[model samples]
Every structure is written in C-alpha cells, then in structure tokens.
Target chain A: MLDHLGEKLIARVSIGDFVVRFDLITIIMSWIVIAILVGLAFYLRRGLRQNIEEKPNRIQAVLDALIDVLQEQLLSNFISTSLARRMFPFISTLFLFVLVSNWLSVIPYLQSPTQNLNVTASLALLVFFTSHLLALRRKGGRRFLKGFIEPYPFMLPINLVSELAKPVSHGFRLFGNIFGGTLLITVVSAMIPLVLPVGLTIFFGLFIGLIQAFVFAVLAVAYINLAVES
Target chain B: MDLTLELGKVIRSINWTFIFTLLNFALLVYLMKRILFKPALAYIDRRREQIASRMEAARKSEATATALVAQREEELKATHEQARRTIDDATARAERIVSAATGDAKKEAERILAAARRRIAQERTQMEADLRRAYAEIAVLGAARVLDREIRIEDHQRLLDTLIDEIDEQALMVKR
Candidate 1:
C-alpha cells in the first residue's frame, strides 16, 4: 500500500521550468468534493416543501441547521444580514474547497493542493486582491490609501509592512499546517508499519483541515468587512 | 566574488514571471466568481427567501389560530350569559306563581269561615225560639190546675187557638 501511495505521488506534469503536477488520486478526490457539494445543493433546493402540512425531511433539517448557524455567525460578527447573505456563498465555497483539499491528504494515495506553497499563495493573493478591490470600490482609492496615515503619519511604513505581511502569513499558515501533517503521518507510518498511524493521520488531518479552513474563511470575511467599512 | 551580482541579475529577470502569476491568479478568481460563486449565491439567496417566507406564513397562521380561539371563547361566554338569564327568568316566574296561589288559598279560607259563622248564628236564634215556646206552655198548664173549674172543652180549645194564632203572626213579623 505504501509503495502504491509513493508511486501515485511520483506522477507529475511539468511546464518548462515550472512543474504543474496532475495526480490521478488528487483529481479523483477533488471530483468527489465537487460531487458532494453539488449533491447537497440539489437536495436542499429540491427536497424542501412549502406546504404547511408537510414536515421538513432529513436533508432539509440538516440544511436548515447549517443555514441557521451561518446566519447567526453573520449577524453577530458581521453585524449585517445583507452583507452576510451576499458574502456567504463565496466564503463558504472557499472554506469547503480548502477543507476538502486538506482532508484529501489523509487518504493513502492522495495529496492536498493546500500543502503546496504555490497553491496556498495563490489563494491568499486572491483574498488580498479581493479585499483591496472591494475597499477601493466602496471607499474610493484616496480613502483606502488614507487608512495608513491614521493616528500618525510616521506609522505609514509600519502599516505598509503589516499589509504586505498579510498574504505571506496567510499562505504560509495553511501550507505549514498541511505540509507538517503530511510529513508527520509519513514518518509515523514508516516507523510503525501498522494501521495505527492511519487513524491518527485521519484524526489530526481532519482537525487541522477544519480549523485552517475556518480561520481562512473568517479572516477573509473580516478583511472584506473592514475594507468596505474603514 | 561576482556571485552576489549574478544573483541580483537572476532576481531581476524573475520579476516578469511573478507578475504573470499574479495576473493568472486574478483571472482564476474572476472565472471562479462567474462560474461558481454567482450561481451558488443566487441559489442561496433563493433558499433564504424561501425560508423567510415560510417563517412569515407560520407566524400569520399562528395569529389566525389565536383569533379563532378568542372568538370561540367569546361565543361560549355569550351562550353562558344567555343560559343564566333564562334561569333567572324561570325562577322569577315560579316565584310569582307560588305567591298568587298562596293569596287565592287565603281568600278561599276566609270565605268558608264567614259562611260557617252565619250558619251558627241562625241555629242559635232557632234554639232561643223553641225554649220560649216551651216556657209558655208550662205556664198555661199551671193556670188551669189552680182554677180547679170544669170549663167547657170548646171554650178551652178556642183560647188555645187564639194564643197559637197570635204566636204565628208574631213569628211571621220576625221572619220578615
């Protein structure tokens, strides 16, 4: 099994000096994630009945609970249901994609894109651009630039450094977590040569995956809100 | 000695690739926004509206049920009041009937007592007359004995007849 997993990882697609690897396992796992999301959407949309006599089915109940939690989070934290509603889909999609990608690494032969610095960096860059773009669009370029000069003009360099650090730290955070988990699982399996490492790997991988995804999505929402408001 | 300069040249050459990656990431974000994010948001918005409308409908139905319950309570109260009024009227009517019966009974008792008193008075008057007659007869007998004379039977008969006729005419005047 280990040998097969190694062979699966070894496969790659290279582009000149840059290598854009495509693995059968990763592709297949990504498809599974997409299918699950699409199925959930369809079930939520089609299964809910409007009649008073009809009771909510299992899928509807699950969907309702999920929406309720999201709504509460948006209302309490974001302070605006309209903005939460507007932003929920994009944020949820990002969370699910990153989470699924991270969790894929726990499988025997699959790898997570989030473990790659390039991929994580790309995602972080997206957030960064989105925040600035929304800020500029809402507050205009002058106001957005004026945010750095607040409290004292001498702090502008510090503010600029902080802004530059945002994407780098965000990307590195995801990459480190996923990559470290993969390395630890690999080392443990090599030492144990048993199924114990698999369980530990799945557990830790899922925990880290969910946490990272939540952090990323929450930070994105906070950044967008802050950009638009201030 | 020239390694640092060579590194600097390489770094300068790599700036274009970095710019290209940034542009590529921007394009991907745009594509994702169009293909995945917008439709998903639309679907979510529709679902939210559906849920909100359902909640509103449930609230309206609850209000309607409350109103119906209040109406039923009011109707029951009115029915109870009507029953109470009917019972009160029936009780008043029963009391009036009982009072009228008692009054009639009292009047009937008084009428019977008056008739009995009148009858008793008439009997007493008759008894007095009989006693007076008896006394008169005894006196006549005594007079005849004391005289000790043999008077004719026809003369005695005529005297008795005269006395009887006088008594009869007196009785007739008293009756009138």
Candidate 2:
C-alpha cells in the first residue's frame, strides 16, 4: 500500500562528500505559495484607507472577511477583542500557510511540504518557540519557568514532559494525516485504476486536506493563547 | 538478535539527520515569520479597520437619520403652531365681522325707528291742523244760524274770536 505512493521525490544535489537528495520542487512550490501570500498581504495593506468613502476592491473585501472571521473566532474563544486584535494576525497567518501547504498534497504530482519531516518539524519548532516566547513576554522569565512546577514540586517532571510533547505531537499529527491520506489515495488508485479510486482519492484527499489544515491552525492558536494566558 | 542490533544502529545513524531536519524546519519557520507573518498581520489590521469604519459609517448615518427626524418633528410642530395661530386669527376675524354686522344691524334698526317716529310726528301735526280747520268752519255756520239773518262783518269777527279761543283750549287739552 505504501509502495504505491512511489519513492519520495528526491533531488541529488551533491556538495563535495555530502550527497543530499532534497525535494527541490516541493521547496520551490512552497516558496511560490509564500510569495503569493506575502503579495496578497502587501496588496491588502496598501489598499486600506483611513477614509471610508472609497469602496474596498474585491481583494480587499476578501481579506477583510478573512480577518473578520479570524477576529470573531479568537474573540469568542480565548481572548479579549483587544488581545485578539494583537495576536490574531500571527495565528491567522500560521493557519493559512499550514492550510495551503496541507492542501498542496491533493494536487496531482505535487508533494505536501508538511509530509516532509523536516518541514513539519521546523513548523512545530517555530510553534514551540512562539509559545515560549509569548509566555516569557506576558509572564516574565521567572513566572514562565515557574509554570513547570505548578501544584507541587513533584509534578515538575510531568509538566516538562507535557511541554516537550507539544511540538512533537503538533508536527507528528500533521505529518501523519497528510502522509496517511496520500498513501491511502495512492493505494486505491493503484488497485482499482478507475472510477472507484477517483471517488476515494477526492474524498480522502480533499477532506483530510481541509481537516488537517483546520486542526493545525486551531491547535496553533490554542497553544499560543494558552502560553500567553498561563 | 542481529536484526534488533541493526535497527538500533540505523536509529542512531538517523538521529543526526533528524536533528538536521529539525534545524532546517526551524530556519524555514523563522524565515516565513519574517517574510509572511508581518505582512499577514498588516493585512488583518487593515481588514479590522475596514470593519470598524463600516460600523462607524452606519452609526453616523443612524445619527443623521435621528437628527433629520427630530428636525422634521420640530418643523411639523412649528407648522402646527402656525396653523393654529392662523385658525385663531381667522376665528377672531370672523367674530369681528359678526359683531360688526350685529352692531350695524342694531344701528340700522335704531335709525329706522327714529325715522319712523319723525314721520309719525309729522302726520300727527298735519292731522291736528286739519281738525282745527274743520272746527272753525262749524263755528262759523252755527253763529250764522243764531243770528237768523245775514251775518254782518262785526258779529262775524266776534264769533270768530270766541270760536278760535275755544278751539285753542280744546286742542291744548287734547295735547296735554
């Protein structure tokens, strides 16, 4: 079943004795998506006006709707409107990037960056760093460290383990979902090679793609909120 | 036993790569934060501003509508007051006209009564004059009869004098 997905798309780019088979296409595609996202952001920022008489263009309206949804979600869930306003951008951006990357797997002949251990692990690490960074920023270093020893001194090891488990879980969850979905689609396509596999491919591929993206974004926002509050 | 040892060796060998991948992901996230996060935040802020602006515009429009309603009410009230004043003025004018007409009617009636009284007085005076003349004629005829002959100038004059005195006294009594 796993063999049906074929070998990983690896590029043999050698640097002297070290031979690294990096997935160049995946990285390039990710860069492209990131560039487009950045461009959209700049465009929206540029179009914003202090005076409301000028109607928002289509792109600006879409961006506004996205932000509004994010703001409402954050405000309702974990934070005050003011704090949500401050923190929503980071959370929303992380979600959008992860969502786009996860969906990338569904595209024929393209690899999901998240399925790559390096990509998922790196994103997880960033989330890990951000959680700590927010904690330190909000509570100060001493108080942030003190969170590990809550309830009793004996619980410190458990707290530490839990803290360490966050990034590992975060990365693994996304990687496993995309990898599993892709593997399933590949197997079905190989076995049936007809109308039946097409339905399964689309269902598992798109549904899992969307769900994984949502999970990643939601978890990220929740983690950030937790860190900031605790 | 050999397979387990090989697996352990493979795990140990892969650990460095795992570490390297972790580092690479960290670097990528860092770069993404710089390149993407800041702009995305700006976009979100822009979006927020837009929503707030729309809310403000709606509020302002509502305020304007309220002010317009109030102004309209004030104008309507003023118009109502002006209408009331006009009605009152019209009523006062009607009252004045009615009173003036009544006064004119009364004055006209009095003038007519006065004129009628003057006409009656004139007719009474004429009647009295006629009665005097008739009485004089009778007195002349009776005197003639008493004499049993033609009345001469001197007797006639005496009779005339006595008759005139009697007639004057009767007329004065009738008048009294």
| Shift of residue A95 alpha carbon in model 2, Å | 2.1
Model 2 docking category: incorrect
What would the per-residue lDDT of candidate 1 be over residues A34-56, giving only the tens digit for each residue?
65556556666554445434676
Every model: Cα RMSD to truth: 9.8, 9.0
Model 1, residue A119: C-alpha shift (Å): 1.9
Off by over 4 Å in 1: A1-76, A189-192, B1-87, B121-176
Among all windows of ten consecutive residues in candidate 1 chain B, which has the lowest summed lDDT?
B1-10
Clashing pairs in 1: none
TM-score, chain B only, every model? 0.50, 0.47
Docking quality class, candidate 1: incorrect
Q: Indicate the worst ten consecutive residues by lDDT in candidate 2 chain A.
A: A2-11
Clashing pairs in 2: A122-B25
DockQ of each: 0.04, 0.07
Relative to the real complex, the DockQ score for model 2 comes to: 0.07
Using lDDT as the measure, the top candidate is 2
lDDT, candidate 2, at A43: 66
* Top candidate, metric DockQ: 2
Writing each residue's lDDT as its tens digit, candidate 2 over A1-230 gives 54424344444545666655445555666665566566666666654543445667775577567766766654356555665655555566666677777766666776676666656666777778887897898899899888888878899999988888989999888878777777677777777888977677667667777777777777777777787786
